[model samples]
Target chain A: MERCRELVRPALVEAVGRLHPWTGEMAAYALGWADTAGNPDPGGSEGKGVRQALTVLGAEAVGADGRDAVPGAVAVELVHTFSLLHDDIMDADTLRRQRPAVWKAYGTGPAVLAGDALLAQAVTVLAEAPNPRAAAAVRHLCRTLNALVSGQAQDLRFEHRPWNGPGAVGPEQYRSMAEHKTGALLGSAIALGAILGGAPDETVTALERAGRHLGLAFQAVDDILGIWGDPAVTGKPTHGDLRQRKKTYPILTALADSGRAAHELAALLDSPQRIDGEAAGRAAALVEEAGGRAATRDEARRHLDTAHRTLRDVPLTRTAAQELDTLFTHLLDRTW
Target chain B: MERCRELVRPALVEAVGRLHPWTGEMAAYALGWADTAGNPDPGGSEGKGVRQALTVLGAEAVGADGRDAVPGAVAVELVHTFSLLHDDIMDADTLRRQRPAVWKAYGTGPAVLAGDALLAQAVTVLAEAPNPRAAAAVRHLCRTLNALVSGQAQDLRFEHRPWNGPGAVGPEQYRSMAEHKTGALLGSAIALGAILGGAPDETVTALERAGRHLGLAFQAVDDILGIWGDPAVTGKPTHGDLRQRKKTYPILTALADSGRAAHELAALLDSPQRIDGEAAGRAAALVEEAGGRAATRDEARRHLDTAHRTLRDVPLTRTAAQELDTLFTHLLDRTW
Candidate 1:
């Protein structure tokens, strides 16, 4: 996967430059660099680029040399960027990757527009691709973004209206939300790669299923790391999700499976980042005590198993598929 | 234009249905319908399909039967929907065409997703349009959205941080912002029609220029109405833009050129949506007193003249082009 990024980075940056040109410099800045005033800055965009990695790996695994996959990679990454930009605004977060979030540094306006620009750029690049496969990939990319937003909207609604009431929301609600928020994009990323590579329909579906579970496991792991992992490694504050009162899998589990401790933890919820450190710690402790942490970890492993299982069913090149499988498993190893 | 709507409405409805199917039902309400939440009540989405009309008109003026312009019709409308969705959040607007705005009803998260969904659907629709020219139209569509957002970001910034401290924005700033915010998309709409119809590159450029001026004229007329139009005709309260403290051409002129009245208005300048009714009337009076309203009207006339000149420069089928020219003039002929 790391090797995949080295292959994709230069193209990614170039495509990004075209995505938001100088006249729209504020949008470019809002995307990943610069402050609201459009001053250039480094370190604004930093993610694993896992979706892009999937695109390259899928294309290569199917013998496309990844040239055809460039559009797929760019389209997938752009969609992800769109989500991140808008999500930051939607969630009202003040930070991303330890820097001022695009919305926070630039503004809600540019931050939102940057996301739109990226999405629009994705379509442009995909449409201009010489291959017929590009059209299918673009269509898939659009649908993926559409579904992801639906999932995100549901997640947002859960916070205010909840599934039932205060202390409501069960595992199914969390599952659906996570599926849309994380799984849909991941599935689309892999599927697009297959589309670019012209993989058989059955194989493409299998790869999508594989990515979907990986995304779910991947999200559960992220949820755990958001609470229990080392902040130095995760690059996010300890219990950041907890403090936000995010209805994450672990929190939802404790609230559903445990009684008294769940009530006590629920009592501590506040307006996300506005919550005090003490309440955050107390909430984290209660999650562990209620066995929610162990349950979430177990669920993540199960999802990973399901992901690997789906890969075995696909008709793929042995050597290429093996590399992709390896990449898939490593996605959640979390030890860096 | 009514004929255009007859063909495009079903598809637009379906495109919007993709907008956060779960939570975005609220946004659906804001677009023109009501939902079961007993909120997000009905309004109107009943605009003449001017964008697609231009596309079709462009096709007819050339030779293509307008089929190539269909995707662009949807694309332009989707961009409009996306802009409205975000503007509701940025401006903290409460209603759209007389119903609760998407953000007001759905919350920012779902509202944002609704916009995203529309963009994706628009892209997907363009991808299916069966011609490379349609694909090029897709490119035009995306570029327009990017520019629109840039202008929107600058507009928001103007309210919070003025470009030149304590003074009116220069005419160039207004033109720049207006071009990006208004002209870009409309220009794309016109250019797309020409391109889709296989017009010569020269003709496309000419039509794009015509559209740009038409766009500016359209916006100026809108701004004029925003200040002085009857509420019933415009479907908004008179001077609602003033109440929002939007720095339109008329107000900026008065503030830049007038004396005592400008001082009084400037005191309420930084505030948004805080001034209404008599204050709104007073603001209008100041613009008129300082002759700014007359100047703005003249500027709008100049834009219309430029549009007419460009239209005259282009090759056009006599009847179709003549009708289009008439439509062009009639856009600014409202009583307001």
Candidate 2:
């Protein structure tokens, strides 16, 4: 993953630089490539490059050198950053990667415009790619964007009401939202990589399925961490999702459990004038007592298992399959 | 122009519907095709369709049926509305087309997402345009988006300081900003239409130049109306730009005039408090007194004449050229 990210970093930087000079500067700052002054900033934390890794690995799985997948990798990364930048604004998050968010540091207007510019540049880079499948890649990316935006719109509308409010979301709806928000992009990353590398249709479809399951597993773990992980280890506040009343995996699962503990959890969340730490702690305990935590863990494992099964028969080389198997295992093995 | 707009309305509606069901609703509302309840709103005022007209006219000039240009037309109009949705949030404007802005009515989060979705749909529509130049058309649209975002970023930055503040803007800088903000899309509208309609390379280049000058002229006239138009007729408050302290074409030109009235206008704008209606009136008068109004009028006429001359030799049917000449004259004839 690190090798793939490092290989694409220069091209990604060059692609962003192709934006108008002012937008280029703001995007550089947002991407951790530079400070607000346009000078390089090495200390800023960066994303883990999971999507880019999927792209490269998918290409290699099709017996193509991963270098040809760099453009697809860069395109996915740009789209990822674009969503993050806009999401931070919509969620009113002040911190990202342990620093002030782009909206906080540069103001909301520039952050929004910079995100828009990055999205445009993403399509431009793909269309300019030296491949016959560039147009198809652009179409896939746009479809992914629509899904991501739809999921975000649903998430925001969900915020206006409590978990038990009218038209309440159930576990199924939550799973679908998860797929739209994260799985769509991850799936597209692999599909675009395979298409660009001239992989067969069945191979692309198989990789997309694997990537989606991997995304689901990854997000499920993230939801669990949001509620129960030690702040020291996870770098997130304990019971953060409970305090925010986010309809994450565990919360939705607990609500659907429809038992005494689920009732108590809902009551506690409904009483919120913003949940205090103690109440958040109690809420987390209630969710666990309702069997939500175990169920969520089972769901994550199920997705991971399905991901492995789907990749089992794909026509990848022996070494490529082994690498992909290792990759899925590593992704799903993040600390609970 | 109205005929062209009406002709493309159904296709535009269908194109937006291709977004996710949730986003399609919001985008439909933002585009004024539907109300907040997701039902058609016939009374809603439509866009002037200048960009779409350029596309159809460009196509007609190249001896193609205007139907072949509908996709490019829809693409440009989508991009235009996308900018409006995001810019309304950045500008904090409460009203658009006599209704509450999308951000004001549907909340900022959805407004931003809907705008992003529209932009993606724009590219997707072009990529699916069934033309050999689809990829090239997508590239042009993306490039235009980058320029538009860059111009908006500069516009927002211009808001942070007085006219004479460090990195102060002059008339030349203002012109570049105008070109990027409006000219880029308008120019691309014509260029894309021509390219997709199979116009010769030189004719495409000529139409692009003509479209750019037409955009500058349009903006210059809009600046004049922003200050001095009848409120009932323009549906805007008197001296709206002065109240906002916008460094519009007239203001920049007056500031560069370096006369006593110009100095007084600068001082009035530099006053720490917000400019009231009374002060706005004074500023408007000072701009006119400093020859800014006449200079701006001259500038608009110069661009219009250049546009006319540039299109003179382009190989178009006599009726098409005559139609275009009438359109340019009509655009520049807005009452002050």
Candidate 3:
């Protein structure tokens, strides 16, 4: 992952540098390279670069140098940042990476423009790639964008739906939303890398499938952390998702039950009162009592196992495959 | 132009249909095909289809059928709608085509998502084009998006600059902003069509130059209409730009002068009180008295003449060139 970040960062910087200076500053701030005042933040802790790492590792697994997939890695990273910038505005999130969100630091209009700049730069980078499969990469990226937008729309719509009834969000709906919102980009990351690495179509398909399963597992873990994880470890307030009344995976699963705890949880959530600290704590306990926590853990393990099975079945370079396996295992083991 | 719209509308509808239903409804509303209730509005008056017309004409001028550029036309129209949707949110304009803007009708989040959906669809349409130059089309569109973003950022930044000071926006800066915000997309529309039609690179370049000049002329006319045109014809309130204290071409030109009228106009604009209707009328008269109106007319005429000269110099199909010439002439004559 460190090597992948090293390979992707310079190209990413160059792509961002092409933006207008005003938007460039906002983009840099959003990407964690600069502070709100447009000064470099040397101590800034950046994203883990999981998607870019997958791109590089996918290329390496196809017997290509990691460097060959730099453009795809950078493109995916930029798209990821673009989604985050826009998502923050849509969600009204004021903080990102322990600092002000782009929309909070620079007004909404500038943040919107910055997100747009990053998205445009992502496409331009891929279109300008020297690889023969660049067009295919662009198509894949656009499809991923479509899925991302659909997923976001679904998630937003879910917020307005009833907690329980005919129109309430179901577990299946949650899975589909997660698949579109989170899994599509990860799937595209590996597929794009494989394509750029000159891998066969079937190999790219297999890697994409594995990447998607990994994404689902990752999302399941995040849902768990959003509710029960320690704030110190998660870098978020305890029960943050519950306070927001977000229809996350665990809550949806908990509400899926027809038992006493599930009914009580739903009644509490449906109340007009805000979910303050005390209510959030009780809601967390009720979700656990209704088997939401256990069920979510099982779901995560099941998806992780499927991802591992897909990865093992594919014919990949031994060293890169082993590295990817270790990385996936570490992801599930992560506390943050 | 009507033929171009006939070829492009079906394709545009199909492209927008690919979005999530929620976003698709908002996009339809933004495109003036639907009302606030998501119902089709049979009586809705649509845009003039100038950009798409240029695209189709560009393809025909290169010896290809108008249908050959439908994807390019659809792509540019989608992008144009995307810009309008986002611009309404940024500018906080409540009305579009005498109806509530997308952001005003829907919420900001949905409007933003709809704009994003349209932009993504624009690229997808170009990427999925059967033309061999589809990759080039995508690159050109991405570059145009970059310019559009930069222009919007500059426009927003100009709003904060003093009307008369060292950092105030200058005529050159306004020109650059207008070129990027307006000219870049128009240029790309024609260039993409020509590329798809298999025009030589030099012909594509010449046509792009002509389209850019046409765009500048068009923007100048829009500035004039914003201030002095009849409200009924423009479908806006009287002195809308002056009321908002927007730094348009005429306003910028008027502020550049050192005469007494220019000083008085600056004082009126710099006042803390909002410019109501009466004050807006006064500002308009002052702008005209300071020669802003006449200078802006000269600027528009110069650009239109340059565009005509470029068209005359280029080796184009006689019928298609004559059609484009007619369109350009009509644009300046338009009151709205």
Number of the top DockQ candidate: 3
Candidate order by decreasing TM-score: 3, 2, 1
In angstroms, the error of model 3 at B38 is 1.6
lDDT of 1 by residue, A214-295 (tens): 8899989988988887988767778888866778888878767546787777666633346557878888998887778988
Pairs that collide, model 1? none
Q: What TM-score would you give candidate 3 relative to the actual structure?
A: 0.98
Q: Model 3: what is its DockQ?
A: 0.83
Q: Quote the positional error of residue A100 for candidate 1 in Å.
A: 3.6
RMSD of each: 4.8, 1.9, 1.3
Residues B1-336, candidate 2, lDDT per residue (tens digit)?
888788788889888878777678877777777788888888567767888988888888888888888899999999999999999988999988877889887887778888998998888889889998888788878778878887887777777656774567878878888898988888888888888888877888899899999989888999999888888878889999899888888988898777899899989988797888888899999999998899888888888899899889687867767878888888778795
| All candidates: DockQ | 0.46, 0.71, 0.83
Which docking class does model 3 fall in? high
Q: TM-score for the first chain of model 3?
A: 0.98
Clashes of 2: 0
Ranked by DockQ, the better of candidates 2 and 3 is 3
Give the alpha carbon lDDT tens digit for every residue of B1-336 in model 1: 877666666776776665666544654564565553634444455456677677677767776666667767777777777788877777777877766777776667667777777777777777667776765666667677667866776676667546235555866678778888888877887787788788888888888888888888888788888888899988788887787777788777777764776666666665544676888888788777766678778888999999989888888887768867887887778874
Worst-scoring 10-residue span by lDDT in model 2 chain A: A157-166
Higher-ranked by lDDT: 1 or 3:
3
Report the lDDT of model 1 for residue A322. 87
